[model samples]
Target: MIELLVNLIVSVMAAATPLLLAATGELIVEKVAVLNLGVEGMMLMGAIAGFAVAHETGQLWLALLAAIAAGMTLSFLFAVLTLTLQANQTATGLALTIFGRGFSALVGAGYVGIAAPTLPKIHLPVLSDLPFFGATLFSYDPLIYLALILLAATAYFLTRTHAGLILRAVGDQHDAAHVLGYRVIRIRYLAVLFGGAMAGLAGAYMSLSYTPLWAQDMIAGRGWVALALVTFAAWRPFWLLIGAWLFGGIMYLSLYVQGLGVPVPSAMLSALPYVGTVVVLVLISRDHRRIRLHRPAMLGRPFQATN
Candidate 1:
C-alpha cells in the first residue's frame, strides 16, 4: 500500500509538472495586469515546434528551446495587438487560441507519427540508489525539478524582491506606477514574454517529457486548466502549487479507478479534472474579498503611459 501510494504521488507530480509551469507563467502575466488569454494557443505551438525539432534533430534541449521561441513569438504578436494597438484583450486572446490550434495542426501534420527523443531522467549518484525515496523524488526528468525550482524562485521574487514589489505595484496601480516613472507597458511586455516562454516550456514538457509524441490538440485543454488554476490558487505561487497537485491527483484517481476495473464510465473519468476545476472556481468565487485582495487590481486592463 505504501509503494502504491508513492507511485501514485510520482505519477501525480509528473502530470502536475506541466500545469504548474504554465500556471506560474500566467501568474506573472496577471501580476502585470495584462491578461493574455493566448496560453492554450501558445502551448499548442510550443508542442508542435518542440516535437518537430526533436524528431528532426534528436536534440531534446534544442527542441525545448524551439518551443520557448514559438511561444514567445505568438506572445509577441499578442503584445503588439493588445499593448500597442490597444485591441480588446478578450477577443485577441480568443483569436490567438483559434490560430494556434489550426497553425499547430498544419505544422505537425507531417510529424504526426514521429517518435521524439525521450528526455533523460536525473539519477543522483548515491540518493538515486536508495530504495524508495530516490524513486519518489530523484527519478524524474529535468523539467520536473525545473518546475519546482521555478515555483520557489517565483515565490521568492514576488514576496522578497524589490522588482517583484514594483511589478505588483504596476498590477495594483498602473497609473500610480506611471506617476513614479516606471514604464508600465515595458514591464508588462517583459511579463507577457516571460509568461509565453514558460507556457512554451510547459508545452515542451508535454510533448518531449510527458507523452513524447505529436497529435492534434494534444495539449488537451491543459492550458485552460492552468488559467483556471491561477484563480483557484488565489494568485499566490504556493497556493497554486497545492491547487495543481490536487487537480493532478484527481485526474490520476480517475485512471486508477478505471484500471481497478470499476464500472465507472471512461467519459466521466476523463471529465474529472474539468469538474474539479469548476468546483474549485465556485469555492474560490464565494469569497469576494479574498479574490479582491489577491487578484491583480488592474488585470486585463490596457495600460497607456501618460507622458
Candidate 2:
C-alpha cells in the first residue's frame, strides 16, 4: 500500500510540475491585470524552442533560457497588439494561440523522433532519505523543487512588497493608478512579459524535463486550465498551488491507473482531467459578483493614457 501511495505521489508531482510552473507564472501576470490568453501558445513555442536548442546543444540551462526567451518574445507581440494598438485582447489572445500551435508544429516537424536530455535531480543529504516523502518531495529534479520556490516567492512577492501593491493598484483600477503618478502602462507591460516568460519557461520545462520530446499541440490545453486556476485560487497564490496540484494529480492519476493495470477503461481515465476542468469552470462561473472569475478586473480592457 505504501509503495503504491509513494508511486502515486511521485506521479502526481511529475504531472503537476508543468501546470504549477505555468499557473505560477499566470498568477503573477493576472495580479497586474493583463490577461494574456496565449499561455498555451507561448508554452508550445517554448516546448519546441527549448527542445530544438537542447537537442542541438545538449545543455539543459540553455534550453530553459531559450524557452523563456521565446515565450517573452511572443508576449511582446501580445503587448504590442493589446497595449499599444488597442486590439481586442480576447480576439488577439486567441489568435496568438492558433498561431503558436501552427508555428510550433512547423518548427517541431524536423525533430519528431529525437529526445532532449532531461534535467538532473539534486538530492539533499539525510533529508532525501526520509522514507517516502524524502524522494517524493525533497528529491526531485531541480526544476520540480524550483517550481515550489517560485510558488513561495510569488506568494510572498504579491502579499509583501510595495511593487506588488502598486501592481495590484494598476490591475484593480488603472485610471486610479495613473492618477497616482504611477506608470500604469509600463508596469502592465512588465507584468505581461513576466507572465509570458514564466508561461514559456513552464512550457520549456514540460518539453525538456517532463515530456523530453517535441510534438504538435503537446501543451494539451494546460494553458486554459491555468487560466481557470486563477479563479479557483481567488487570485491568491497559495490556492494557485493547490489548484494546480489538484489538476496535476488528476492528470497523473489517470495515467497511473493505466500503468497499474487498474480495471478502469483507458478512455475514461484519459478524459478525467479535462472533465474535471469543465466541472471546475462551472463552479467558478457559479459566482458572478466576485471580481476574479478566472480573470482579474480590468483584464481584457484597454488602458489608454488619455481615455
Candidate 3:
C-alpha cells in the first residue's frame, strides 16, 4: 500500500510541475497587480515554440529558452494593450489566448508529431536513496526542483524583501506607491514580464518534460487551472504549492482510478480536473471574506504614475 501511494505521489509530482511553475509565476504577477490571464495561451505557444526549437536544434536548453522567449514576446502585446493603451486587462488577456492558440497552430503545424526533448531527472546523492521522502521529493527533473525553489524564494521575497514590499505596495495602491517614490508602471512591467517568462517556462515543461510531444492545444486548460490555483491558493506561495499538489493529486488519482477498473468510464475521468475546480471554487465562495482578504486588490487594474 505504501509503495503504491509513493508511486502515485511520484506520478502526481510530475503532473504538478507545470502547474507549480505557472501558478508560482502568476502568483508573483498578481502580487504586483498585473493579472495576466494568458497563462494557457502563453504555455501553448511555449510548448510549440520550444518543441520546434528543440526538435530542430537537438538542444533542449536552447529550445526551452526559445519557448520562454516566445511566451514573453507574445506577452508584450498584452502588456502594451493593457498597460500602454489602457485596454481592459481581462479582455486583453483573453485575446492573447486566442492569438496564442492560432499562432501556435499556424507556426507549429509543421512540427506536429515530432518528439519533444525532456529534462534529465536527477537523483539526489543520499536523499534519493532514502526510503520514501527521497524518491518522492528528491527524484525529479531539475525543473521540478527549480519549481520548488521558486516557491520558497517567492514566499521569502513577498514577505521579507524591500523590493517585494514595494511591489506589494504598488499592487495594493498604485497612487500610494508612486507617492512613495516607486515607479508604478516600471514595476508592473517587470512583474508582467516575469509572469510571462514563468508561464512560458511552464508551457515549455509541458512540451519537453510532461509529454515529450507537441499536440494542438496540448496545454489544454492547465493555464486556466493555473489561474484558478492562484485563487485556490489564496495568493500565497505555500498555498500555491498545496493547491498545485491538490489539483495534481486529483488529476492523477482521477486517471489512476480508471486503471483500478472502478466502473468509471475513461471519458468521465477527463472531467475530474474541471469538476474539482468547480467544487473548490464553490467552497471558496462560501467564505467570501477569505478570498477578498487574500486576493490582491489591484489585480486586473491598470497602473499609472501620477506624481
Best by lDDT: 1
Decoy 1 TM-score against native: 0.97
Output the lDDT of residue 188, model 3. Answer: 80
Model 3 TM-score relative to the real fold: 0.95
lDDT of predicted model 2:
0.84
lDDT of model 1 at position 241: 93
lDDT of all predictions: 0.90, 0.84, 0.86
Which candidate should be chosen as best, given TM-score against the real structure? Answer: 1
Query: What is every candidate's alpha-carbon RMSD to the true fold?
Result: 1.1, 1.9, 1.6
Q: What's the lDDT for residue 25 in model 1? A: 95
Which 10-residue window of candidate 2 scores lowest in summed lDDT?
A: 288-297
Order of candidates by lDDT, top first?
1, 3, 2
Which residue pairs clash within candidate 1? Answer: none
Q: In model 1, which range of ten residues has the least summed lDDT? A: 129-138
Residue-wise C-alpha lDDT for candidate 3, range 47-166, written one tens digit per residue: 888889888888988987998898888788888888888899988899989999999999888878867567778888998899857776667887888889988999999999998999
Model 2 bad stretches (over 4 Å): 131-137, 262-264, 289-295
| TM-scores, one per candidate | 0.97, 0.94, 0.95
